[model samples]
Target chain A: MPVPAHHPVDILRFNTCGSVDDGKSTLIGRLLYDSKNLMEDQIEALERSADITGGGQINLANLTDGLRAEREQGITIDVAYRYFATPKRKFIVADTPGHVQYTRNMVTGASISNLSVVLVDARQGVIEQSRRHTCIASLLRIPHLAIAVNKMDLVDWSEERFIEIRDQFEEFLPRLDMKDVKFIPLSALTGDNVVEPSSKTPWFTGPTLLGHLESVHIGSDWNLNGFRLPVQWVNRPNNPTDPRLHDFRGFSGQIAGGIVKAGQKVMVLPSGLISRVKEIWTYDGPVPEAFCPQSITLLLEDDIDVSRGDMIIGPDNLPGQSTELHAKVCWMHQRPLQRGRKYFLKHTTQTVQAVVTEIEDRINVSTFEPEPDAPELALNDIGEIRLKTAKPLIFDGYAINRLTGSFILIEQGTHATVAAGMLFPPTEAVKPEYTDFSI
Target chain B: MNSYHLDHLQYLETDAIHVMREVAAEFERPAILFSGGKDSICLLRLAEKAFRPSDIPMPLLNIETGHEFPELIGFRDRRAKELGAKLIVRTVEDVLARGLATAAPGEVSRNRLQIPALLGAIEEFRFDCCVGGARRDEEKARAKERFFSFRDSFGQWDPKNQRPEIWNLYNARLNAGENMRVFPLSNWTEVDVWEYVRKEKLEVPGIYFSHERECFRRGGQWLPIPPPHAGAGQPDPYAGARPKPAEKHAKLVVRVRTIADMISTGMIESRADSVDDIIAEIAAARVTERGTRADDKSSEAAMEDRKKAGYF
Candidate 1:
């Protein structure tokens, strides 16, 4: 219906996270600088303010630290986003701070990313914050994990040190469920192997960090199995002049998972009514098919009563519909989450009133242990909790479909998003008795 | 039929449509902040994709500072009519006349004064969400704004306490007076906007391209020379809605990169007469898109100061 540009480079949303001194901001600054994405005014601003924030040289970190206080303190207080591109792929980097108190920021920034770059100083090795960032990325289910062992030059470009840090990650990575992991040695400050190949690393034979990032196989990252479309709204353009707008009723939503064909049979959730997909309409025209993550309007064969917050799914692979939800949550508000507190629960297109029923266990990030008897979860605390909703929610486990599986909790009066929750089955954690269990 | 991948523009279009639909479904009453600028023009096209077949589900909202270019105003009214949507205008002159807002002494720019008029309009209409075309790459302060930025009852933005927007789930729940400033173009940059415009063959105002205008130089930028002779000392050229200055104006070859209020917007001497020419000029231009904005050049944190007072 309009002009169309046919460049198919997928946009990769990723984030760079590490400790305060681990050069997370510097890495982002380097990525933007090396790509020459900084406009003249921004560069001039940097040069003008160099004397104030930097110790002589132009501080690349000054580009990302937006607030005055952040510039004054020489730290990142909030999650900042930066975008750059290569011919192979367009990139969006969420530069999240690594403060222990701001784990909520990390969780939120990493939630929508396809990959995560966890930086560690070569001299300091893997610290608590390193494990914390890795664990958060794993919990967020980022498909690809890139552990950048930065400051290789500071360690005389030692392969042994890089392998040692990689070994530490190998021991800790098994506990999480990340499929693709890459270990790269570089220096975020000295520009070694970051965007260019360093001459000192003759022993190393891998692509530069930018090259690897541009070539990562992320096409299969999205789940394309079960068809799930949470109906966002109804498109009824009752335009009298245009025939297409005459009695044009369509179910509109972004496809959360799987593939949908024009004539496929589908079921409306919460109400077990079945119907066939009459047509799939895109802005371009009526396409024969559409896939996951594309926004489109659907015309059903039958005029069933479907509205916002309703679910449209395939009959073969059904999701669990329940009023009670057991979830792993990352608390964000200063007011600790407690039992009997009613909050607004938002999942995909649906929002309902839900209350905390029980606190199963608070996860200690450093030790990877569960404090099962904790009374309440404080800010930035990750815990397993039980929630009871006033209405049934159709959702898959977070392990299957991230879009349908995750939800957020909003404070009732303030409307601030207090926690991010991932849904799972409320199964008993009782270990069955096993005598002489062998592998 | 199996083309699963979308170009960057198509993906951005899909994203904007999703956000628009979400606002329409979640908020009780929503309005789109239309400035008749290129970004807002893209927003209008996105609305068409989102809820068309029917009239746009929301009204077009604009805060007039009484200092807009005549071409911009003409384009704004015509586009609104063409789309069959109600156009709501809140003027700063009316607010000043009613003594609802006061300007600092010698404050020639009415950019800050428009905030109160806009907030007044939101309150009078009881709008829950006001969608805007603000992008993150415009300035440093705007870079931190989320897609669903929350505002207090006073219509003030607390950059420190913004809600974390994860995935596409926007929290649009608001109290009676507290509204949300939704930015669907948060991820789009200036280059992306131009590419989309060229791709969609969207019609923009004549001022964006090379045009002839009578103007004077101020702060190294071309300002439309106020109609007749201003006899020294009596030069409040933008004072009131005086009859469209009608004196024979010595016109110059100038074009503006942004279609803001005429007094605050700057013009450049260029021969870029077509969309392709404009795109090529932008590709080679060294200055940032907002570098020529007189209002933003007033202070380093000018945008931040205005946004705290609910400036879209």
Candidate 2:
């Protein structure tokens, strides 16, 4: 079939995780290869490389397992991104390493992913790394989970083998809070039930990987229930040459949530005064309405006051504004996250001085349980912690809105990203103390 | 065309536009690093989309190494005029005349010298932000870069000290004299850029497409013959000396790849001559675009090392 001009397939951002030699790379490679997304040069290079296995054909795994060390050792060491497009959707595949040492890299890749593809070798069933990845995925609140029982051909493509793995995953699913979970049994190497249905697995009936990706309900993936647009910059051309731009004021940002339309009442956070959306501006042109995650310029009916680092939101359903916050953080730095350690808390467009107030507990990945009274969080550790910001921040629970509810902890001295955090339920509900404070 | 998904292209487009706006709003003086490559072409298109009906809001800066393809230079000039934006050309030859950059004895490539030329231009313009089309997926060191990457006063990028970018919140704040290298297409892949160009119907240099050229094998890859003014002491500069008599001659055939400088960039043997052919070729190929870059073949971290010294 010839390539189409306008295939408006849905978007799918997914991460892959599995134990070493569990065929994670093979799964992604098969998806891209079988889908005919691998470029001609890429295929030729793969074929020419000495790393080609016994079949004398190109190693699909080499497409994603990029690092020289990883290639030499036959493992993934860092997060590699792969892109492919089908008629139904466009996919950004985050091929994360599965080694126990590279867990931090996996967390980084999985943080932004909407779906987590957990590959389980049919023989191994469920391993520690598989559980660890699923826990991390659940902790990150990925809405969808697909347990790909790979190497089915190795296990004789037996339906019993697939069921055995599925049953094991089911026992652990109730322990975590995943909204939608699916199980697919297929051999990524042989291209069974990936983009196409497998006649071999007639005993087990389910949608193909491609079918699931295309038909999945992703419109509800974004948090459209709450209105949040953190102002990245205040657009005031103030150029007299273009009189139209003279006194043309607009706050530009990607909407974090909710529907924003012309004439909708909105409030600028930190300064509680209310205003109306005069227009929603985009690169193409002005639109009557805009929604979450769409980068846009909003012209206010009344230019009462606004600037970068401020957030514009619906006055009725405003985010929780407080200086203290309790959140689940995935510590990413080698340096431990200790109480009283000062870091920059970057939430939306605002960065403010912040300190770790307390470490409630660190969740053990292997067992998917929390260990109480952990003093500090080391690298690749997930924990619930309380933080005190130098200034107030307006945010919602991460479950409700991924954009507004997420933040990063920047090391004060080096400015490195130390942790990825998801705001939990506020520990204290306190009213905003109105005061004129400037940085 | 029927299987094209707009969401992926649209997402990449939106992300690039957002980064452009951030550079405009955050920096005092900004410029787009126009290399006349596919990536930079995509960046120029994104900039047009970002602030159209009002110029690009910044100048298009090209640090000419004097080793660029002639076709590329012509395309760059014409495209700049088409967009009605200022095109600022800085040359290493000028830096050489001023003694700011000096080539080593018997050196053929001025790529190493480009660092000084680029830094000199940044200082001359007092630009706080320089928008580029670098993608993180291109290299390992780039994988650690933020959308709004910070550079020291000397224009050095310390990958280990990059700011954490979370949930699209970019921290563009920097001290005076320090500049930021903004990569709006940091998230885009090579295929994504081509698909975008096809989708947007963007015009790029003809050299990008498959074309017949006088080329020979050198350092395990193909290199184009230097232009007449390229100072020839080097016979078969396209092909390094080999044992076979037939290998001494240059091969005139269509080439697929055109990554960086014509002198250093290797060409892949190909029959695909159009965008559709190139796309089909790419869809079936396993080799990366960087596979043909002779400079990168020098070492594993050649791109990273250059990047640290402020070679954008």
Candidate 3:
């Protein structure tokens, strides 16, 4: 009867990135403040905090920099996530630190974000940190990018100043593969054009930051071209009271791509066995259809031992399954990522023993160029590398789907996530499943 | 196709389910840290959705401070039985009895002792991952936590050195002595929880809704002092403060915002009779749900310190 209900409004996951002094936190604080999302106690805590600035004004950055060290040091060292919703959309903002040295944390925040907001101070137009953050957003393949040229109030809301920053971003925007990029000029300190359009800036006309955030076109962000469901668990309740729960064996996973219907032809990866969906089940009840991002338990018509780590996909467009993978990785550890280092590679629900076969090259974040002859990737280094796994991984190119394309490296000894990787298009792009002429 | 969209609450439910499944697939021994709160109640429904035809892969664990509400304990047992899941409980009193945890001389709340009781349970049961219901929006320290948060061999969390969790690929690898605290509700907010509860028609304790109760004001919060509070030495927070009874008429209709211990839960004087009313109140309330929490009131770094010592 519940029908695995669907909401009218879409949910958007985005992140805010800027240099240390670029007012990234202030911008976020203003968004929360203007949206009435901040709680009174949180504001009271802010007012009571001793970390107020010289000018005082209830230091809005205190809303995010909640850690004691960050508050004392006046710099955000890690990624902090904030949530707020309007009538139009629900938003999850991963406010990542923009100290170029902490780029690894930026990558972590960007991996799951659908959009990225890169703030730039109007005084220092398009600095190296801005370029680095924009490059990182592009590298992570976040679908949307919003460039907020902040401190417009300080510059007297000059249209020339706003256009100068916009042109600077436009110069570098072509080199990257950003599809949807929007530029908004505003002052985070004065709350000029963050939530509501400011009357002061009559020369420049653009949606306010919050307005753009609420109306962004993110429906196409998910991969609808192909179907992918990486099985995370096997749901077998086997309840004695109810016959349905008693023997209902459902393969559970979040649909990573496309739509799945009750009778669609699907194939389980690694096994290569085809099956038809018997029923799509949710906690509320069975649904006729399910799609990408919906975690559902499936009752296959002919179950041939499907479990966690296996993938259920639309047989028409199957993902590649290879023991060896060429991937672009962002090294996140102190010890340099070099060839022949064995680590635990976690891709989706699967974890396998993987050894770095080769370190190809590193990408320079500032210029967006690849550097050859890199012996090893140091901490926070973005590099392309090859890996050989103990088992085959079912995945797509990161450009296709972030859920299936992304993975993280866990150092075998310390068990720390050492790298975030995106699958590089292999030389042999046509996968084994596609080689079959017989449909 | 129905345009392939889930409501925000449903999306959160799906995300939490995926986290649970990942933990189930990866961890050697995993458990859900149940506190009988709304978050954990949502988690029970998720755990059921995750592994319904079979038994839940892990047991439900609770680190009791020995001062929890009787209603919570009863609801916990009943719900655990309803789901046919194992409920493993370890009390701070037991830890104190065994001399593993010592209380500060005048400490009334055993909130700090909960860390040891929890870590001791992990060590005793060899649980590699304990799924908690902590949301990022709850507190500042919690905002920086990963869905699969790592705890080192010392049973401590180093907030500075957290692993870079990218996307849905959670690194659940751990050493023999180490364990991971998985938060399935990391992305869920308070409003989403209430919406999901109302949609699923899930059962929570009666305390969540409006109820008449005898309460007292301590540090500007209405705390429901249970019957055993009359002769407590250092176990009652009001021992030194001498918590005053709100003028007899002050025994107004109130509801528990968060289900902490009877000593720590800050009651909101409300007439929220239903889930919709609760949602409306939460939307309009100026104070955060955790702001009413007595345990996190000490200082700005209380949650961080408690987390470092491995408190859920």
Can you write out model 1's per-residue Cα lDDT over A85-132, one digit (the tens) per residue? Answer: 666778877888887877778886899898999999999999999988
Better of 2 and 3 by lDDT: 3
List, residue by residue over A250-322, the lDDT tens digit for candidate 2. 7887778887778887778878767788888766689888876677888888868887778888744557888
**Top model by TM-score, which number?**
3
Q: List TM-score per model, in order.
A: 0.92, 0.85, 0.94
Model 3 chain A weakest 10-residue run by lDDT: A429-438
Q: lDDT values of the candidates?
A: 0.83, 0.78, 0.85
Which should have the higher lDDT, number 1 or number 3?
3
Q: Rank the candidates by DockQ, best first.
A: 3, 1, 2
Real A-B contacts recovered, model 3: 0.83
TM-score of 1: 0.92
lDDT of 1 at B187: 82
Which tens-of-lDDT digit does each residue in A1-439 have in candidate 3? 1122235566899999998898999999999999989988998888778344434458888889978899889889899999998878889989999887788899888887889999999989999889989988998998999999998888888899989899998887999999999989899998988998999988867899999999888777777767888888877654456765666788889999988889887788888877788999876788988888888888899948988889988855657788899899888889989899999888888888999999989988778889987999998888899999999888888888888888889888888788999997544432444444123
> Which residue ranges in model 1 land beyond 4 Å of their true spot?
A1-6, A238-246, A425-439, B213-217, B220-235, B239-254
Evaluating just chain A, the predictions reach TM-scores of: 0.93, 0.93, 0.92
* Stretch of 10 with least lDDT, candidate 2 chain B: B236-245
Model 2: fraction of the reference interface contacts it also forms: 0.29
